[model samples]
Target chain A: MNSELPFLVELIVSAFILTGAGFAVIGALGLARMPDFYMRVHLPTAGTTLGVGCTLIASVIYFSFSLQTLSLHEFLISMFLFITAPVSSHMMAKVALHTGVRYVSHTQGRPWPSRTQRPSRDNSQILTEWPKRP
Target chain B: MLRIAVIIAMLMFTVSVLLNLYRMVRGPDLADRILTLDSLYVNAIAMIILLGIFLGSTLFFEAAMLIAMMGFVGTVAVCKYLLRGNIIE
Candidate 1:
């Protein structure tokens, strides 16, 4: 199998795979190391977007070359991932907001609106007040 | 070179899965656990794709697609439940 693949194609595929893997590792590292839920929530987008994208691109290139036919099916997974990852993350963020998950001290603006506070016509006043530290 | 790259990628993905597991277990909040599970499935898809490439087969794409669909639905469902206290309303 190795001998049949052209040297350049192998190099390209290897590079893509390694790049994707690297992004996934970095994203996971951020997830593990981040100090708060809000900060951690932002990290996985890196893995879901570029990391999966590179791997699928490598797959498309490798299969298309080796099979002598255009292999475009991998794009389906990529498209689905692109569409769904953000939606899932957004929903998760909403969950975090509704549940009032704790955030680090430095985060600007109130992380979650208080349930007792009525929606005011002028929202600027809400943003102007710093949250009291517990 | 491709073979070595696949091995290294597999190892990296394994590490990623482990790290996600750590976050899921140690996360102080429910949202954190749900978020970790979401990324964990994505990492699993990546690993499956790598395995398919290593074996020189196209069969795994279907499984990966199914996982992608199911993972998204599951994440959304859990998030909705957490947000609204009900899966369907």
Candidate 2:
């Protein structure tokens, strides 16, 4: 409905928007279908990073062209998402590791090291020093 | 074309949100639920942004940004709580 925008700009914007949405849907499908917690954890990063990134880019292009001004503000959201998505995913994965969430049998690492039998000396030292509060 | 695309995109995002909801409800592990919550907020932000674009208004950008910040902080805080059993320590 934005009449001011040219045909090519509209085409580009729509393409990007559709692509982003498709990616989001695919990611969500993976989240819903993945067999294990760790696999499910990997799916959302696809949505948060690339899916949102494409939509943000489309928004930037649409607004910048429509308003006849540089609309770089969406970059803030994009950058924030890019940085935080991975961090949050990493943290969640850490929580999974700490909680010993179950994984599929086909997973390459069949048996994760137990807390008492950590693979590294430094990690063992840290685990030993870590207080176990009841 | 653009309007149609926006409408379709909105519907897809809605479907995605619903999928996330399903995962959240059915997740067997606490970490799984938390991860679903994190992605849920991100999808919500995308929906807000799409709405803003459809309406040709910049007002929703701030709301999207706020959601981004708050979602990240909440995820991190919850993760910390799960890891150490205390958020601030």
Instruction: Return the interface RMSD of model 2.
Output: 0.9
Per-residue lDDT over A40-133 for candidate 2, one digit per residue giving the tens place of the 0 to 100 score: 8889997656888999999999999999999999999999999999899999988888877888887656546556334543565677887999
lDDT of 2 by residue, B20-73 (tens): 999999999999999999988989888998999999999999999999999999
Task: After superposing candidate 2 on the true structure, give the runs of residues whose Cα lies further than 4 Å from its correct spot.
Answer: A110-134
Question: By DockQ, who's the top model here?
Answer: 2
Q: Which candidate gets the maximum lDDT versus the true structure?
A: 2
Per-residue C-alpha lDDT of model 1 across residues A1-134, encoded as one tens digit per residue = 43599999999999999999999999999999999887898889766567889999999999999889999989999999999988998999888887788888987667647552235435577667968778
Expressed as tens digits, the lDDT of each residue in B1-89 for candidate 1 is: 89999999999999999999999999999999998999999998999999999999999999999999999999999998877668999
The global Cα lDDT (0 to 1) of model 1 is 0.89
